[model samples]
Target chain A: MTRLNTLLLLALAVTVPLSLLAGRVWIDPFDPALPNAAVIFAELRLPRAVLALLLGAGLGAAGATMQGYLRNPLADPGLFGIAPGAALGAVLSFWTGWAASGWALPLFALIGAAGAMALLGAIAGRGGGVLLFTLAGMMIASLAGALMSLAISLSPTPFAMSEIVTWLMGALVDRGWADVWIAAPLTLLGLAVLLRAGRSLDALTLGEVAARSLGIDPRRLQLLMIAGVGLTVGAGVAVAGIIGFVGLMVPHFVRPFTDRRPSSLIVPSALAGALLLLVADCLCRVLPLAGGELRLGIALSLLGAPFFLHLLLRLRRELA
Target chain B: MIKQSNPTPSVRVERSRETGARRVSTTLDTNGGLECAGVVLKARLADVTASLKPGEVTAICGPNGAGKSSLLAVLAGLLASDSGAVSLDGQPLNQLPAPKRAQAIGFLPQSAEVAWDISVETLAALGRLPWRTSAAEDAAAVQGALAALQLESLRDRPVSQLSGGERARALLARVLAGEPRWLLADEPLANLDLAHQLALLARLRELARRRGLGVVLVLHDLAQAMNHADRVLVLDLGAVVADGPPEMVLTADLISVVWGVPARWLGEPGARALLPG
Candidate 1:
């Protein structure tokens, strides 16, 4: 099963790049065709596709890491406050006009994610279980959502509101290579940290006491996992805005394929995530909705939400 | 019955250097074994002091509120005590890192809850975490443990699909794969049937004798404890009331005092006392 999953991931990694190359074309064909095509392919489509892949992989891998670290199957960065915290930070930066420069938004987003995770650690420390953590995450997410709404409502210009709305809806449109470069390194670094913590994650499956008996410090592992997820999800959201369901769905879809071992699940989840995002982006490009400029987030949620619900129901039945 | 001779096979025991009052600890010769002295464990509630020797199945029999599990936890280094210390072969257990401690001790908690769905072999390999050895070595150890526990056919099956007894045996395989010196089991026979209960006790005793491993089990069943344990410690509330051979510790008065149940002991010499209804 693991072998088959690895093969599928390898195939997707190759195909995604080829698809990005084939799909990129100049919108304005009549004005100096060859150079325009080259510029469009190099500048816009290539970077956007790369960003999609990176962000997708980051969120998916982070989600899997968080789930394993927490020993909770339902955990994901999007549902568990990391994405919303990052969104809040970016929006706050944008509202303050501090992130007018290139990298400020992502930097602040990472800080916000770190802050949220720290808060989660504190809350979870006080005799709280996964349900409590989930509630706390939901509360933080809702609070962030309200703050974002207030920021949009109070903005002096319609242009700022429009930008915020587009971000909230999520889009890979008009992203440059510079944005991709900014987010990619941070996300990759987070993935590396998570992979290193894989063995600790396996120990954690047997509960905190057993893990400790096996010589894993559960508290330290938890903190490291939170940091890793924080960095990746923060950078991901800052780069691509709020792309939901990829983190939540990809891990579940890829878990059985990896024999449900956290050590083997990380890379597969990342690959599946990248593929899911790339395919969603491709559909966004070709779909007739909104005159072929549909938001990738919308396309993703449309496909993912029902599947997520179905999974929840199935889990509920199994537990019952 | 495979020549049930003296369980403690005398081998070359390496003795650790002692300072003044503390005695030198003995190491297992080829076979796995453990030796502890002046082991004091303190928790929020109480303190416990005891010593465990190799090649004996010792049952820490106690009431519900007794510090049996806590003692096990301290010995396993899952919980750090306040003052008194534990040492394996005169080496301080506290000085060793978590991984090294794991290499020397195999702990089976009363209940092990796992969320991930994985095959039995994969689960058993988790025991090799402490060894930090190669995957091939881990695989071999897991296979040996599985065969020892009669779980060869269930190696590829998911742990979630196994019955409770099967799961317990699979988990036992995971712990045994570590090849630790001391086996610390908390209520290992809690949910097993009569046959499985006897089987588990027999297996533990066999391991302690054949491998020279030190076995310390926290047990609630007086009959099982009396039957299988070479030595027994009876605890009530938070203190040890009696400690010695099973015949001496499993008395009617001790059972009545510790368990608050009307019971009697009936046995001949070199036989286990039966508790009748």
Candidate 2:
């Protein structure tokens, strides 16, 4: 476990500097002729890099926890509907022209996330099993997704419609230190919560009844999962729109290196997740697309969908 | 004819005092292994009352839908009975903290599943979840458990790669790592071959005798119960029909009345087989 952590941390150290340097401006530290290089580094790249680390780490840890809870390697935090719910909240802010006011967009998204979490908890009820929880989350995701579509169709103006669409695609363009401040603590807090659930998640690997007999309180675990996924995903949607797949893919990448225990997967997954988003975001900046920079969310999905397909095929082979 | 063993509290007290002085420090309670009074779980279990003692292998035997598993679950504190109470070592089970209760009682479900591709050692180490002990302590316990199950060679192997008997042993090793005073299992031998079943039963009997563990198993094979278990508790529907030494309690008449099968025991004592007509 320590070896994996050390390796990932070393990789992160290398990638962070590269990510900051490899962007559109490409500021060389040795060059004396460059103007506003420090400004570009301080004001623009640093916060974005920090934001990537925070959100990616949060997403990765969340994915590991989710997979552990469901006992399915393919399980993703998005299965809980918190991200979609947060996106719906953000979409409403734009639809009603309230996003023009500072903080209203994030506030609305967080509210939406809270609503989804509350609904999930209520529907799951007491002594509810993982299957029941998954079904409830799927229902909430579908409901939120439909509501988001309705909001898009009823946009106040074409510009508002376009803005909402663009934001929904998810990016880190023009994100400032304010966004970093917003995500830092919430993501950290979310990671802490997910890590706290790690031992219980490991117990769950023996199935529900065995886990309970091992002192795992199902209701308490459910609460931790909801809160942790809610904070991380909701905070990401609030700042960077709807970035996806970091949570889904990072755990898979790190699983082979660890002991395959749920608790052991969390930290390494987080570090790898941070590395993945930073590298992906840097790639989006330099990819030379004709229609401006590609959205981070779209970029990940482009990479993620194929990865997902490969995973499914491999699973089929294993089962066969 | 069935012979009922009378409860002798004074004799049991004196025996407990002697055993308590000789028992390992990890054994949490010196008295009252596990007791359920008037436990009722809707239609599944009805007003079941029994007291199980440590250092004995007690087989809970009954036909399908006869509430054997339910009684075991209640004893393990996994299922709350509708109206009765399950106590461990004279303490009301539900009132105790879950971690403390877990430290004392290890339960293996009927079809325990390993959800991840974790190593056998890792899976066995999961029993230390309640203790959260030092790494050295955890490793030692896991090692002991693996050794007991004859899984030391397979410790590094993944659980998915294990054979049926090996897998069952690995799952039981997880329960053993906790060093629980009570070990309760539901149909633990159902999926194993005859040889594996006999091997596993021998290990359980040894643990009960050597470590003073209270071993309660819901068994479907009557002959196995008759041969391996020191005491047998026979259930009909949801109540205890017979509870005593297996030789006395598992009479041919009790078998016919409970199972609706005219089964007869053949072969000498300790090597008998059931022949059903």
Candidate 2 lDDT by residue in tens digits, A1-320: 49989999999999999888877788887894688888888999999999999889989999999999999988999999999999999999998899999789888998999999999989878895899999899889999999999999998899999999999999999898988888888888898889889999999999999999998899999999999988888898889999888988999999998899999999999999999999899999999999899999999999999999999999999999
Candidate 1 residue lDDT tens string, A192-237: 8878889888887887677788888766676666667877887888
* lDDT of candidate 1 over B162-215, digit per residue (tens): 998999998889899988878899999988998899889999999988998888
**Per-prediction DockQ, in order?**
0.64, 0.71
Q: What is the lDDT of candidate 1?
A: 0.76
The TM-score measured for candidate 1 stands at 0.88
CAPRI band for model 1: medium
Q: Rate the local accuracy (lDDT) of all candidates.
A: 0.76, 0.88
Task: Please state the error at residue A183 of candidate 2 in Å.
Answer: 1.0
Docking class of 2: medium
Q: What is the TM-score of chain B alone in each candidate?
A: 0.83, 0.89
